[model samples]
Target: MVRKPVVSGMFYEDNADKLSSQIEDSFHSEFGPGKLPSKKRTREIFGVISPHAGYQFSGPGAAWAYREIAESRPADTYVMLGISHSGFPSCTSLEDWETPLGTVKVDKAFQAAFMERSGLKQDETAHSQEHSIEVQLPFLQFVNKEYKDQLKIAPIIISEEQRCKEIALSIAETIKQTGKKAVIIASSDFTHYGMNYGFFPFQDNVRENMHNLDKGAIEHIKSLDADKFMGYIDDTGATICGRLPVAAAISACRILGAKKAKMLQYYTSGDITHDYSSAVGYGSLVIE
Candidate 1:
């Protein structure tokens, strides 16, 4: 058995029934469940960008992607690549991530192959308390009920730009070799809007500016232009914490024949709290 849920009571409801209701409520409240578009409208998801903030702030944005993933034929595994805030040389850390819904077993066979091919060591410290990876679990549980029993996940915490690309490419290679349809999620929040994030150029206009930047970022992803993506961040100083993950996802998606990237939803914490002075950006995308 996998490790039990560690962040249920704190990050989300600890009670199973309450958690289920809340997750479903979140999905409907954020994006109307009744009006969910047909799966044919969106392309297959090779990778998606989700936020890592507390559920109160980013859960809705996270739900957009999770709901979409759930509607599609369920996958046998999920590969999550998250950002690392701790100071350390970049490496892909591994662990069996848990949630109150149930534990998502790690794919040991795939993990062993990934390590042998990528030369990245298995470091528990990378995932011990990283919120980026943990924040995506509840959405997974809500989207896939069989997650606990049938689905497995490979959790990798990335700390450096080069390492992020290396790991992403290695995983793409692994997927191709294994002939498995796996969903990859890159958890990150967009520009942190205020003095707290050190990116207050827009002042009260931060919210408007962030929406524009997010649009531009989504466009770059559509082109699968890694150089353009990195350049976009460099040029804007946009403050996206998942820069590497975004870039790598673009690269991997392009190789997989993803022709277009559609922005499913984009919003800031201010949308929820109405406090524009300081906020975080959240966006969800689907690559077809």
Candidate 2:
């Protein structure tokens, strides 16, 4: 029953009514394709990689994945691996994510398995204000009606560490061992823009390098090559905060017999707001 509020009212609407409507509107707005291959080629998805930014910025990209989930309506459980902004030393942190809609329960059985597999301690304190995962709930409420009562999540907050892959692999293995229907959601935002975020290598320009960098990294992800992905991160220093989660999800999908990934949508806030000086990148990808 421990609930965390994280990025409430800032990343998303705080009010339930407003949040619900906004998410619905965003879901309806997704259209067109991107640098990735057509979605018509990929199989049904086991899960998705989505941005956790505000509704105005990344909501549409996030919705493409959720919309696929809604249309398919997969069963079993959901495990959301999100970035830990708390700077905790923990390899993985787990807790219940709360929003105006309702509390999404933690699947205790899966949680116990994850704890044993990852050997990571639970820190409810870290989950209290971690926005990365919590922001996705309102969209879930919009997409999945069955989620209202049965929704359960294994919320894991990952940190930057030498053994990130070890922890990620263990968590993924635990999910596989469960032998139940489930979906893995990775919450992440690609590239923070402007000097305030200190990653202005492009100097607020809408050049192709920014897009290419993300495309290359995402290509590695699509191939389910975690080692190559880690190498890319080391080489390019791409500013994706949820790399760990995406890595874990890709690994888990491969283990679960998922063959490939398809990019559903990609966009930057600049495309919507006409402010290239500072923008956050958003993308949606699915593994089948």
Candidate 2 on 1-288: residue-level lDDT in tens? Answer: 567676778888888898877776676664422222232422456888988987878878888877767766555677788877877655344456678777777788888888888877787777776778888877766665555788777777777556567766776687678876788888988866666577776753464666777888889888888778878987987888888888878877777788888888877777787776777778889887
Can you write out model 1's per-residue Cα lDDT over 1-288, one digit (the tens) per residue? 344554667767888788777776666665323333244424356767777776766777777777678767666667777777775444554456677666677877777777777787776765775667787887887666654587777777666776666776887887787778877787878877788878877755666787888778778876778778778888988889987777767777777766767777888888777788888888887665
Off by over 4 Å in 2: 30-44, 91-95, 204-207
Candidate 2, residue 261: lDDT: 85
- TM-scores of all predicted structures: 0.90, 0.89
lDDT of each: 0.72, 0.75
Q: How many residue pairs of model 2 clash at the backbone?
A: 0
Return the top candidate by TM-score.
Answer: 1
Alpha carbon lDDT of residue 46, candidate 2? 80
